[model samples]
Target: MGFSAEWLSLREPADRAARDGPLAQQAAKAAGPNPLVVDFGCGTGATWRALAPYLPTGARWRFVDNEPALLAEAGRVAGENAELVEADLGEMDALPLAGASLVTASALLDLMPEAWVADLARRLDVPFYATLNYDGRMSWAPAHDDDAAVTAAFNQHQQGDKGMGPALGPNSADRTIALFEAAGFMVLSADSTWLLGPDKAPLQRELTNGIAQAANEAGAREAASWGRHRHAIADRTTCHIGHIDILALPTGNLQESTHVLR
Candidate 1:
């Protein structure tokens, strides 16, 4: 399904925090913020604000989003450092990241299948700071064991191909680490979770709906079960939690690479 402006507006803060916590920091320390950052599925430029502070002088934030509405908002949000690029990630050929110092996207990678992630990462073997992909279980307050059937069904729903080819589903969190490892990434560091509670958190809300919708779509049996499951856990509000993976991958052979490059 397509994303909503409300969704983007809601998750902006936590999204920004996730970006700041790990990937952005390492990138800034490793090579300075002047590096070219291409945000796949930029979505109103929420990720840009996080990347802004640590950024060195004259750094640029190139945002890519297929939706024109989002592009307008992203351009506005990105300010002087931002350059809005209107395009969809599925159209890999149309949107290339061969020269970018970093390729990043928040809550975007899991939406696509394994092949596409591989394709994009292959295009640019640079550091990628990807975060907020839902891992399919959310429990707040007292906390409890996650509903297995609901989790399984919901995961299938999340993986329900949103057209860019079959997505990696809730499992993408784990899959991403493996993907990066095989890609020759050195694996700098990571933030494995984004937990949300009754704090009325923005990203929490975005992910709550995602988990519920997935449960609803998985099938009637699961839909009915998760409905009660959610209600029963009212004592402790719960929703899917997302994780961030930060990497400092070398582009074009790190061993032979120089600090200064073309």
Candidate 2:
């Protein structure tokens, strides 16, 4: 389930546009001044770039990823204030969380199992901010007959093991909220959908390809045909992909948890 830097770079703009800005602002405020933030699965530092401007001036960032190349690129992009740590998120027990004021991840939770997420929730005592978690809603303008089948198959594929046991897929946001709440955290969530038009042809094509691949892997017989048709009309089509941004603060302090976005 490794993603190339090129693919991550391609999706950066849409990712930025789709994230909940107000939620990020709330997270920044909740983190306090000069917070030390630990970002998991920080691919190419897009999440860092998206949140850095909203956070305090002297805030420190620790970017954790298992990919060395991505870590290098993140370090280069995030400047000297960022410390890159190469570690496997699948093995969360060994992760270092010392002195962290906030924990964050983007496009990550949906790929993990419920137990893993619960473990993370139990371990994290600080405020948590996660964005771009897939909510399983995919729509296309100028719809085709095979759209539903492909989407269903892809969603099914999303639930299969992705190195962390059975993934939560579209159920991630709700599961995350419940997990954190059970761990004494107050959670707030917001919709962060990606609306792709002709202007985003590259991302559209990549997304189509990825979906088709997943559907095919899930044993959808018409996936290849659907992919070909989608690619042919992608330049003229629009796609709406759903996601969620969440912020969780420890429940003890009502004042700090009250600053969440509605």
Candidate 3:
């Protein structure tokens, strides 16, 4: 339950991205004429809000998530512009919306393995106008590059397997690229890196928790190693950072394609 109500209170996803240069540029590239934008894993609808301006006016957004509390909060945040679905990805399976354009997810993808992506892409009717997902990109402040021993240990720890099948925070970017291409996508692939300085608290905190989660999970088998990190994060004296690979690909070009113009 790391994604608490307190986390949502800290800031809006829109404002967080507005303040970030690299993310803003990538987001602009994802904009244009997407009519029915489906945001998978749309927690609190913050990701939707961040990409809302880019979608066509009078367009409706479909947000899917399994958490009722999160979906309810998203409903409250999104109002009329949003259609919240409180079920798994299976709830509203992907089927080309004929003219409907694009599918987006932020800070997801990495958690899932290749099979899930394949199924979703097939359902969505592959070759999405664009897709951007970020993950485990939590960072700590007063970052100590000099703390190599702890940091390296922590980096390896964070990049370690999350028992979710594939190692998410480690090398997911490459896997994502290959999967998309294999699915018949003409992809624009790039790594989207988010660096947090002390000024940005919410993003910074998210990074912090994410790093702590990774490290904790990574080192769970070793109690002594795990306990040390748990204590340090509670004390709040470290910094963390991570990256997500961004991809923009056309769909139905290979597996199947469709166009939606507003």
lDDT top scorer: 2
What TM-score against the true fold does each predicted structure earn?
0.81, 0.96, 0.67
Q: Write the per-residue lDDT of candidate 2 for residues 108-196, one digit (tens) a residue.
A: 99999999999999988788999999989999998989899999999999999998799999889989999999998889888999999
lDDT of 3 by residue, 175-206 (tens): 66666666665555444444444445545545
Whole-model lDDT values for every prediction: 0.65, 0.89, 0.51
Pick out the ten consecutive residues of candidate 2 with the lowest summed lDDT.
253-262
Report how far residue 181 has shifted in candidate 1, in Å: 2.5
| Residue ranges of candidate 1 with Cα displaced over 4 Å | 17-20, 31-33, 140-146, 201-209, 220-225, 228-240, 251-262
Question: What TM-score does model 1 achieve against the real structure?
Answer: 0.81
lDDT winner, 2 or 3:
2
Ranking by lDDT: 2, 1, 3
When 1 and 3 are scored with TM-score, the better candidate is 1
